[model samples]
Target chain A: MTLEIQNASARAGGREIVHNLDLALAAGEIVAVVGPNGAGKSTLLKLACGLMPLHGGEIRFDGSKIGSLSAGELSRRRALLPQECPMRARFTALELVLMGTAISGQGRPMAERVAIAQDTLDRVGLSSFMERDIMTLSGGERQRVHLARVLAQLEAAARNGAPGCLLLDEPLSAQDMARQRLILQIAKMHAAHGGSVLLVLHDLNWAAACADRIVVMHQGRIQSHGLPRDILTSELLHDVFGIPDGCIHQHCSTGRPFVVPHDLVMPEDINKRETPCILQ
Target chain B: MRAMRVHAGWILLSLLPLLILVMLVAVEVGASGAGIGTLLHAPDVATRNLAWMVIAHIRAPRVVLAAMAGAALGAAGATMQGLFRNPLADPGLIGVSSGAALAASCVIVLGVDMAQSGFLNGWAVPLAGMLGSFLVTLLLYVFATRAGITSVTTVLLAGVAFGAFSGALTGILIFRANDTALRDLTFWTLGSFSGANWERIGLLSPFLVLAGVIATRLAVPLNAMLLGEADAALMGYPVERTKRLAMLGVAASVGPVVAFVGAIGFVGVVVPHLVRLVTGPDHRLVLPGSALLGAILLTAADTIARLVAAPAELPVGIITAALGTPVFVWLLSRIHGADIPS
Candidate 1:
């Protein structure tokens, strides 16, 4: 029950973004794609979700080309949270979550969908804020609303025991420290519950801890792919991220390989600019 | 709830006086400002013939035509606001009305006499205007949006560009016109319910009703759309299709009204907003309320237009602006710097 990408390529305005990338994620597994800025992390997620047309190769979910799926079918299988979706409406947390299923064309009665959305909000620890407007919420709370929406899609998909795929593009990037770890734990719980996840995260330490496999990307190409401990090595980090050796240390707590940078370096030092960090 | 009932009561009480005044003024202006109604009902050959000519051929059709045109413009404005997800989106503000005006002016100046059977005259200009509006709006939508999603900023910027261009072209056409052509074009641009007739009323009615119904059907999707395209698309909506449909619906509704009325402004922009303030932003309630409020507001304005000049009869558009501008300023001043959502 794994999703596979075979030599998949995508280009925007004739400029290649994701180049000949191949990936496979087993059901109930979490894969994190870490890359330097302009390494096309978001583009890869866009390609996977069929938001952008693939220039070459294929993406298959359960051995079928994802391109052939109807928009509704594709949405039912996987949900994508774009890097910056600024919704204008001042809906409650529950309504925002309901919109996720709405994309899949749930077309259920408003009351039932509202109930499901409220339940999802409660599960995501936003029960008390069910009636509060999303615009009034903090960035962390909004991210949780986003997560709850995606998780709601999965929970609804659980009837046939088919785990939904959550494709999050830098879900925790805009979030603070405490919310970041909380989101990672929630993602881990989704995977543990037999759901699939493919995340684009800059924080390698969090990915190393939570992800089942780590795929390192450099210049739109895969640099390494393996378990976190095997792939997130000092030499690979220096080569891909331009981090000097021994600067970022891997610390294990709760039996996860967590890494952190001991030194401060501007992301521009890597010479790629589009990748966003929470600091600014 | 009591407030709504009061608003409704005010509308109803005000509506009766408006209807009577519209009927009286339309009769007085269309013919000589005389006691034509009493004279026509006088049971004499010339009197009865004149009454039939004035009432059947003129005033009744004009009042109904004004009502239909007003309703259509108001509804279209509501739809455009829903389309932009911006409360300030008025049909006239974006130049859909100007595009329609230009088409209508051309038809009038060129004198495309479609009244061969005498039954289709009122409809001919409106049809031309709707076609022109459809063309211009379609072009704007195509040029503004590169992909499936339309960036709001891009749409607005493009609208301003197109609107200015269309207005310039309309000015050029008017400038080049002869005396009679200029006079005809002037009233059309200033907005008139003066050219009201059975044919015009009939032509606008179906389009208005259909556009209103289609907009209501889209209310749920439109509300979801304000959350953003990605969010709307995820919510089982055909986001791109919905946007296109709503834009087309706005043009379809607004185009004919503008063609006939000559750029009636403000009602579309103001009525929905006022409704939103009372009912919150739910389109389900907003669409219907905007339509009703628009009809009532326009009828009142036209009645005032007749009363203000009494004998001369200034255009309804003038009255609407005179009354609505202060309200617009008040609404604007009331906003305590809420962040403008992009």
Candidate 2:
């Protein structure tokens, strides 16, 4: 099944934070949406997940309007692991993962669901911290637990060939190098199992290395959408990012994307002085 | 081998009966000394009847209502604290109880004589009181909830505004009331169970039980809520609706308690925190635990309030404030230095 956003937009405080934008995701595909700050990448994901009200446009899954689905039904299809997930209640690593399975399997025996949760924890490499409180875990560890919860959500949703999709808003913001790779690797597994993923990432190289496709966002609009090699060029990067063609990547044994500042080209020269810029 | 000793299972087992004990004891004992023996005696005996009448009819109703009030306030306080994500929040200080107080006060001060003169008997009082509480709470809730969710700051602000409006009206009514009425109104504002009777008790029992059941049922939902709405929602919770239902339940339950029992200050704010410390943020534990703890604290306070003056009486709210505030402060300090409620 495919998850699609049809002209989805979000208005906060009567101003459109995310204007009308359309996108779609195919099974086993991980798409990274990269944008400058305030580009509405996060809002788009929220709108699709029904976390935010539909200010305008419609979100659909497998050609069905998302608004038509029940809250429980919608949750069973896709899960979102939000960026700022500092919990008001700190659950144990196992308990946090248990929550993901709990929602879909609410009718099942509690012990049964709990057993599934333990398995998910083991899969996420958090079996050792199952009983450890979330507070004791460092930032990277918490992210793993959250990602584990997302995996459990999908696992519960995997009944009767249900669509398993994950929408992550900067899932790796506060993590170290190892944790970042670990999260993306888990996401890739979720996709390989016929799930779809829409990731909002600031790190272009990480996105390039992980995502099958990349979408570039600018000021609440999508500037370009294509394969990583097709879109992560010097021109698009400099124009949308104003990166001065400086180093963002380095030679990597891991075959990861890295940038080196070959020359410090000005935005004016890059854009051919066509667009008026206020930024210095 | 260790599978035999689950701490949570044992705690739940112990706590369930403790909840029942608090409820039964609070309703059984009173000025009549209707404790273990008296509660079980035959109603035909004169002393038994007198004790029964006093216990079941007089103090029992009041104590039952007090427990209901305490539970609702505690539940509401817990929900509001979660909503605002602030542990220090109190509905009275933030002004929800005052708003209800204002609404109820308007009925007590103004509607009393008119309803009596109409020969409607006491029905009009509760009706008017209920109307006042419902209207003010509804208005305040509406005012506070702008976006889908109700923030603590907005709810607190709206409560303050609504409370001030109600308080000012209460002042006006007090000024207009006759000397006896003014004196009576003073007791009502401070909160007392003196007027409690079986009819009032019977009338209130359903609301209390219904609300309490629903509130207790919210333990799991509330446990999920501690993760905050968005994360909870993504984890398969309907975020906005969960919040709305909780708010409605708290308001509907607590507004009446405030109306009946003046502002029983700090029971809501104090009990939940204490329950959380003992049981952690698992609402399955905290909600029921808070209900029992609130009932125990309020009933004890009410008993002490009665005993302290012996033949005279003190407002239960004062006793609760006098005792609860210090205990609450101690709890705050103990939970301190640890942030984010682990």
Output the number of the lDDT-best candidate: 2
Off-target runs (Cα >4 Å) in candidate 2 are A13-15, A54-56, A160-163, A245-257, A262-280, B1-56, B90-96, B115-119, B122-124, B144-153, B340-342
Backbone clashes in model 2, listed as residue pairs? A249-A258, A249-A259, A250-A258
Using DockQ as the measure, the top candidate is: 2
User: Global lDDT of each model?
Assistant: 0.72, 0.73
Give one digit per residue, the lDDT tens place, for model 1 in B90-131.
Answer: 775455776787787777666545522376555666666777
State how far residue A231 of model 1 sits from its true place (Å): 1.3
lDDT tens string, model 1, A22-94? Answer: 9998888999999899898888888887777889999988787986887677777787777776765556676
| Fnat for each model | 0.37, 0.63
Backbone clash pairs for candidate 1 read A102-B234, A102-B235, A102-B236, A103-B234, A103-B235, A103-B236, A105-B236
Top TM-score hit:
2
What are the per-residue Cα lDDT tens digits for candidate 2 across B1-342?
A: 112224644664675576567657666655556664764765557777776677667776777676667667777777666656678665553454666666556666777777567755755545555566666656666776775566656766776676677778878888888776677677777778777776776777777677766665566666676777667766767666766666666766776676666667788888888776656666766666676677767767777777788778899878888888799778767767877443
Per-chain TM-score of chain B, candidate 2? 0.84
